[model samples]
Target: MIINTTHHNTEHKQIIADLIGSPFSLLQKFKMKGVGSKRMIIDKVSPNMQSMMNKVSDINYANIELRPKGILVMINQGLKNFTWIIPYYQLTIYKVNGSSLHAQGRFVHFKNNKTFKENKKFFDKLLDEKVRYDMLFAMPQGI
Candidate 1:
């Protein structure tokens, strides 16, 4: 689900929380080592998500924040902010030419630039979280 979070909206907050679980407590965040990624330059986005990017700007930037059961991909457009909520089961990430995050038929590609290199550890942490979440539903070996 994508929401315009430039302003504080109670309904939006509730929806996001229900979709991906709530934000982690300070202690949880501390144990996770960190739950956010450094800013990254966006290289491209799925055609359906073109509107979320600023066409006028040559470069777009985004960052990711880890949630208990999912992750939030936050895109900035001038003064406006858009967030894409992706649960662990629905999220797909790839690192071909650069980093690509896809969910709900939309995707955003982050350039493999300096900023992306700086976020290597964060990406690893995200994958680990996803694996942990998925294990909760693992089937029995003989089932």
Candidate 2:
């Protein structure tokens, strides 16, 4: 779900928390080292997501925050802030010329540039967390 987070609306907050789980506690944040991604340059976005990055600027950027059960991709377009909520099971990542995150028939591609290179470690952590989350529901092979 994409929501305009420009204001601190209680309803939006509740929905986000319910969908991705709440933000990590201080201890969890410290233990995890960090739960956020370095800023990334946006190269492209699915048609439906175009509006979120419509404002012309020197660069369109986004960042991701990891939650217990999912991830939030926050995008800023001028004064408006939008977040794309994607649960672990619904997330799909692909690395082509650049990296693209896809979910719910929508996708956002990040340019494979300097900023992206700086996020190598964060991406690794993200994939690790996703795998860890997936294991919790893994069925027995012989079942």
Candidate 3:
């Protein structure tokens, strides 16, 4: 399951526990630490999905070296099964400009071409060709 929490309130904690079993377990494995903040988690994914994440990580590191902006792309596979293939994804861009940090993100159902195209355009404009190309091919359809 994928979990996106903007607040680490009581309700949020309870929900996370119910969904994932134990917060401490996640923390132990991922070595994550946050008292109160927004968090996004991908509980489990297929090997293919894990490979895509590695590609995104590589792109993120490369972009950091070349530009002030960096983008992280991820596919979230939920716990429930889908009759047809479902591609739920999110992209987040983090920019550093002379001591200031800025970020923008979008979540989309990957079957939507319009949304996918829009995101591709934004990333192409903000990132390098290599990063864009990697992202394009990382999709399940290999677009």
Best by TM-score: 1
Q: Cα lDDT of all candidates, in order?
A: 0.93, 0.92, 0.29
lDDT for each residue of candidate 2 in 19-46, tens digit (9 for 90 to 100): 9899999999999999999999999999
Candidates in order, TM-scores: namely 0.96, 0.95, 0.21
For TM-score, candidate 1 versus 2, the one ahead is 1
> Lowest summed lDDT over 10 consecutive residues: which window, candidate 3?
59-68
Candidate 2 Cα outliers beyond 4 Å, as residue runs: none
Better of 2 and 3 by lDDT: 2
lDDT of 3 at 92: 35
In model 2, the Cα lDDT at residue 60 comes to 83
Q: Which stretches of candidate 1 lie over 4 Å from their true place?
A: none
Give the per-residue lDDT of model 3 (tens digit) for 1-143: 23333234686445434432332344542432221112123222334334323333222111111111222222322322111111212223332221111222222223223333334433444344335545765847554
Measured over all alpha carbons after superposition, the RMSD of each candidate to the real structure, in angstroms, is 1.0, 1.2, 17.4
Error of 2 at 127 (Å): 0.4
TM-score of predicted model 3? 0.21
lDDT of 1 at 18: 96
